[model samples]
Each structure stands twice: as C-alpha cells, then as structure tokens.
Target chain A: MTYCVGLFLDDGLVMLADTRTNAGVDNISSFAKLQVFSTPGDRMIATMTAGSLAVSQAVMNLIQEGVQDPETGETATIYTVPSMFRAASLVGEAVRQVYRTHGKAMQEHGLSFDVSILLGGQLHGRTVRLFQIYSAGNFIEATGDTPFLQIGEHKYGKPILDRAVTSETNLIDGIKLALISMDSTLRSNLSVGLPMDLLVYRKDHLEGPSLRRITEDDEYFLMLRKRWSEAISEAHRQIPQPDWGF
Target chain B: MTYCVGLFLDDGLVMLADTRTNAGVDNISSFAKLQVFSTPGDRMIATMTAGSLAVSQAVMNLIQEGVQDPETGETATIYTVPSMFRAASLVGEAVRQVYRTHGKAMQEHGLSFDVSILLGGQLHGRTVRLFQIYSAGNFIEATGDTPFLQIGEHKYGKPILDRAVTSETNLIDGIKLALISMDSTLRSNLSVGLPMDLLVYRKDHLEGPSLRRITEDDEYFLMLRKRWSEAISEAHRQIPQPDWGF
Candidate 1:
C-alpha cells in the first residue's frame, strides 16, 4: 500500500510519496515511489505511483522506452514530448502497453493489474499541468476546479484536501496541507511510512529544487509531527466536550 | 455504500450510520444501516452494517430470528444474549448462517458475500462492549486501549476518532465528535450521505432516551453540520500553513 499526492497550485506543484510497500504485515519494505524526469530548462516531469510495484515499475520502464505515433514513426519520450499534454498522453500510452503485455498473465494468478500514476510538471513553453493516470491507461487532466490528485490510501487523508486545497492555493501552503494530510494518514495507518520522497517544482523553473529523502532525522518533518499532535490535543481541550455523557 | 461507526467508552456507546445505499451512482436510495435491539431496562444492542446490503440485511434478519441452541432447546436473540460478548458471537453466527444460505449464489453472480458489522452496547449485568464482525463471520472485541470500531467509508471520519475518542470520553462529546466525523465523510464522499442515524446509549441504562434520526432539516443536526464546518475552517486558519508556504 502507498499514498502519493500531487498538488497543482498557482505557484507550482507539490508532490509527496511515502516509500512503504507491503504485501502483508510481515513482508514490509521501503521502495522509492517518486520518479523525477528533468531536462534542465526544457522539461520536468514527476510521477508518483501506487499499487502493484511490478506493474508500476514496468509501466515506468516502458514509459522511459517512449512511444511511437502510428501516423509518423517518430518516437516521443518524456524528455522529447512536444507539450505537457503529449507527455501525459505518452505516459498513458506506456501504461496501456504494459497492461497489454503483462495484465492477462498476472490476472490468471489472481493479481489485478493495478497501477495509478500521478504526473505533474512543466514542459518548457507549456503551462504547468497535473494528471492522474489509471491502470487502464486512461487519464484525466486536473483543472482549476480540481487542482490536486491523490492515489492509494487516499481516504484517510482526504478531509484536509476537501477543506483547504484549491487551484488558487500557493504551492508552499499546498505542500504543508499535503504533508498534514499525509501525517494524519501515517498516524492512523501503518502501511504508509517514511522516508518520504518530496519534490517541489516552481512553475517554469523546469527543475525541482531540494529533491531529498525525508528520514527520521529530518527536523522540519519531526517538528511538524510533534506540533500537529500538540495542536490537536490543545484543540480538543479547548473545544467543549459534549454534555451528553452521564 | 455506507459510513457507520460504533464507539465504546466509559460514558457508554455511540453509534452513527449514514443513510445512503447505492447499487451504482444512478441507483441510490436511503436505507437505514443501523439496527437497534433493546429489552428496555435489561439490554440494548446496536448494530451498524456495511458492504453488500443483501448479505448484511440477510445476516441481520437471521439474527433477529432467534435460533434454538443445539445443546439447549431454548432460543436466543440479541435481547436474550447473556453478555455483550455472547451477543457479538450471536451476530457472527447469524452472519455465518447468511453465508451458508446465500454465499454461493452471490459468488455465481460475481458479487461478494461482503458484509461487516459494528456491534456495541451492553447486556444486563454486563459491561458495555464493542465488536467488529467481519465478512468471514470472525469478530474481534474492542478493548479499552482501542475503544472504537468503524465500518463502511471509514477513513474520512477516522481522524476525529483518533484525536478525541477514549474509553473515558463523555457520551455527549462522543456524539458530537461522531457527528463531525460523519460530516467530514459526507463532504468528501458522494456514496455516503445524509440523513444519519445516531444512537447514544448510557451504560447499564437500557432505556435509551437519546436515539434519533438526524435528517437534513433537523435543527440540532443542521446546527452541528454548520458549526463543524466552521470549526474546521477556523482550525485550519489557526494552524500556520508553513514558513515555506509564506
């Protein structure tokens, strides 16, 4: 299980992914689920994946292999895709290809070919865009009305998104809210754990600043965790408990 | 889909259920997912159901139809259960009976014998207890360390429980917290909606004066819905988004 969220805000994009993957309670391991594709000033595409690690890794591998347009034999890779839209389409096409190749055999063994991809970033001259790509390889682009997308273990962290996330939100604020949402989920569920993979891209920068692994020693995250817990306890103390108890 | 939560606390028990049942987005109807069985001053058992409505309803109905114990010719029902633990077993047994009757046919129809239940309340001469009954008819009782069980669309309402609920919580506060949790789920999920059914039972007081249907128009519920939304926003505002966000 995993939790990956990408926020597309006016200032830029905030992408966060937990590294925990578990087949069962005992078979837990850490795997980096956040992938960054950058060509300096030309393009920057980030993908956070959840679900079958095999399917997602295959999909990512195939995506790196690029796609060829049937009309013209020219190949379009993430780095070469003409627009953010095409890059997203190329990513979706790669997922479709992987599904076509590996989906059937996996299903026979009672495995569902599950993989969801969050692709977000800028491509040179194009506007910053965000998309959630499904296992079927179909994808939907985020718009102003719905400016963020979450995949895997989403529910435990959704309330904050519903209340605070908006297209007009600043990217940094979006990051904070996303972290809090993730923090809430991490506290309630054991499947989502650190070290977290966080990437923040300022629109048009065409590169992510501060790509880092957030481990236990990370000061900001530790502070955020402690402060948030304290705040909740204080909030509970301040709020009047219901008068219904005998 | 439904969202129901049953909490066990020092004050007593708090059970809440949303009233939405849907076969699909288009085929939605309101069906109470909560069932109460009370013998006035002797016992009160509250059950919240989730998953395939047919399986749950069948399980619930079978529980309602008292069965003769093979060892003893006497029949037993929820109200007749000797303890909350026995009551939980009876509910689990009824679920197993439903599976025995309908599991194969549902599987043939490509549907799951998917049913889960949250049972909480007290029996005469016993302490308040809570149990989570799974589809397989196995159940786990809630201990003081973890005094709540949630079923159906549970994630959205879980944070509040994680923050405020304890074995010693007040019933009125428990009720309010449950409402706020329900309100969060209602906002985030179309499959889970109003009107919600809420029951507050005081320990050892089998005669409940606090069970009611909270519809869209009920004044107290309306006030709660509005106040909760306001409280969330106010809380969000008070939290510093992040130094980075600024």
Candidate 2:
C-alpha cells in the first residue's frame, strides 16, 4: 500500500508520495515511489505511483528506458514527450504494455495487475497540467473545479483535501494541506509509512523542481504533525455541543 | 455501503450509523442500519450493520425472531443473552446461520455474503462491552487503549477516532467525536448519506438507551457539520508554513 497526492494550483504543482510497500504485514520495505523526468528550460514532469509494486515498477522501468509508440514505432519517453498530454499517454501506454504481458499470469494466482499514476508538471509552451492515469490506460485531468488527484490509501486522507484545496491555492499552502492529509493517513493506517518524497514544481520554470525527502528527524514536519493534531483537537473542542439534551 | 462506528468508554457506549445503501450508483435507498434490542432494566444491545444488504437484513431478521442455540436446543435471543459477550456471540450466530443458508447461492449470483456488525451495550449485572463482529462469526472487543470500532467506508472517518477517542472519554465527548467522524465520511463518500441513527448507552441503567434519528432537518447535526468543516479549515490555516524558501 502507498499514499501519493498531487495538487494542481494557481502557481504550480505539489506532489508527495510515501516510500513504504508491503505484500503482507511481515514483508514491509521502503522504496521510493516518486519519479522525475526533466529537461532544463523545457519541461519538468513528476509522476507518483501506487498499487502493485511489481506493476508500477515495471511500468516505471519501461518509461525510464523509453518505450516505443505502438503506432509510430518511434521511441517515446517521459523526458522527450512533446507535451504534458503525451507524457500522460506514454505513462498510460507503458501501464497497458505491462498489463498485457502480466495480467493473465497474475490473475491465475489471484493477484491484481492494478496500478495508479499521478502525472503533474509543465511543458515549455504548454500550460501546467495534472492527470490521474488508471490501470486501463485511460486518464482524467484535474481542472479548476477539481484541482487535486490522489492514488492509493486515498480515502483516509481525502476529507481534508476536498475541503481545503482549490485551483487558486498557493503552492506552499497546497504542500501544507498535502502533508496534513498524509499525516491523517499515516496516523490511521500502518501501511503508509514515513520518509516521504515531496516535490514542488513552479508552473513556468522548467529548471527542475524543489525536492525534499521528509523523514522522522525533519524539524518542520515534526512541528507540523504535533500542531496539526493539537489543532484538530482544539477545533473539535470548539464545535458547539449538541443542544438536544446531552 | 454504510459508515457505522461504535465507541466503548469507561462511562458508556456511543453508536452511530448512516442509513444510505446502494447496489449501484443509480440504485440507492435509505434503510435503517441500526437496531436496538432492549429489555428495560435487564439489557440493551445496539447493533449496526454494513455490507451486502441481503446478508445483513437476513441476519437482523434471524436475530429479531430469535435464533436457536445449537448447544442448548433452545431459542436464544439478544434479550435472552446473559452477558454482553454472549450478545455478541448471538449476533455472530445469527450471521453464521444466514451465511449457512445463503452463502453459496449468493456467490452463484455474483454477490457476496459479506456483512460486518458492530455490537455495543450492556446486559444487566454484566460489564459494558463493544465488539466488532466479522463475517465469519468471530469478533474482537474494544479495549481501554483502542476504544472504538468502525465498518464500511470507515477509512475516511478513522483519523479523528484514532487521535481523540479513549476509554476515559465521557459519553458526551464520545458522541461528539462520533458525529464529527461521521460528518467526515458523509462529506467524502456518496454511498453513506443523510438521516443517520445515533444511540448512546450508559452503563448499568439499561432502560432503553437514548436514540436519535438525525435527518436533513436536524438543527444540531446541521450546525455540527458546518462548524466542524470550518474548524478543519481554521486548523489548516494555523499550521506554520514551510520555511524552506519558496
């Protein structure tokens, strides 16, 4: 299990992903789930994945090595995609290829070929975009009305994102909300662990993104965790008590 | 789908369940998922169901009509149970009986014989107890350290319960937490909807626990929903921003 969230805001994109992966309770391990492909001054695309580690890893490996476009016979890679749209299509195509190869064998063993990908970034001449690419190779982009996308262990952390995020939100605030959302998930579920990767991509700047590896020793995250829990309790305390004869 | 939660505290028990059930997005309806079996001063047992409507309804019907105790060859009902532990077993037995009768048939029809129950209350002369009964007729009790249990669409509402609930929490605060938790689920999930049923059982004085059917017009619930969302946003606002230089 993993928890990855991406926020598409007015200024940029805020992406975060947990490193924990597990087949069973006893087989837990840490592996980075955030991948970046960038060309200085041209494009900076970030993708986070969730679901079957095997499927996601295979898809990522194919994308990193540059997959061939089935129709054109030309190599299409995340770094070389002409637009953010094509980048999403490339990722989706990679997923389909992996499923086509492994889906049948996995199903026989009662394993799912499921994987979800969140693609976010900007191409030099194109507008910033965010997409949620599914296992079936179809994708949905986040628009102004719905400005965020999440994959894996999503429900536990969604209420906050649903209430606090919007297209007009600032990148810093978006990062804060993403962390709070991740905090809620980490607290309630053991599958999504710490040492998360956080990346912020400023809309027009293609000179790469600010990446931070958040771990237990990080002072800011520690403060945020403590304060967020206290704030929630304080807020819970302030809500007017039921007046229907408690 | 349903979102039902039960909290076991030193003072009493808090139980809440949403009413909406659906086979598909278009086939939705409101059906009471909470049931109370009380024998005045003798006992009061509240059970909340989640999962296949058919399985839950069948189990409820069997419990309501009194299931036979295989060991004693006599009718065993919630009202006749000697202790809260036995009451949980009674509900589990009812569920198993339903599964015995319909499990294979339901599977053949591409349906699941899936149902999870949260049973909480007290039997006179015995201790107050809360049990999360599984589909397989087994259950685990809520202890002092982990004093709450939830089922169906539960993840969205679990963080608050994880952080704020405990064995020492008073019934009023417990009920407040439960409502806030339910509010989270209601906002994030369409499958769990309005007109929830709430019940609170105080230890020892089992004379029909307090019950409230919260509908869209309920003033207290509406206020709680509004204020809780505001509180969450306010909390989000207060968390210190990243100092890593935007």
Q: Candidates' interface RMSDs, in order?
A: 3.0, 1.0
Supply the DockQ value of model 1: 0.47
| Candidate 1 structure quality by residue, lDDT tens digits, A53-137 | 9988887786688777545877878878888788778888888877788889998999998989999888778898999998887
What's every prediction's RMSD, in angstroms? 2.4, 1.3
Q: Candidate 2: which pairs clash?
A: none
CA shift at A121, candidate 1, in angstroms?
0.9
Evaluated at residue A223, the lDDT of candidate 1 is 76
Instruction: In angstroms, give how far residue A115 of model 2 lies from its true place.
Output: 1.1
Fraction of the true interface contacts (Cα pairs closer than 8 Å across chains) found in each model: 0.40, 0.74
Sequence-dependent TM-score of model 2:
0.97
Q: Model 2: runs farther than 4 Å from truth?
A: none
Top DockQ hit: 2
Best by lDDT: 2
lDDT (Cα, 0-100) at A42 in candidate 1 = 84
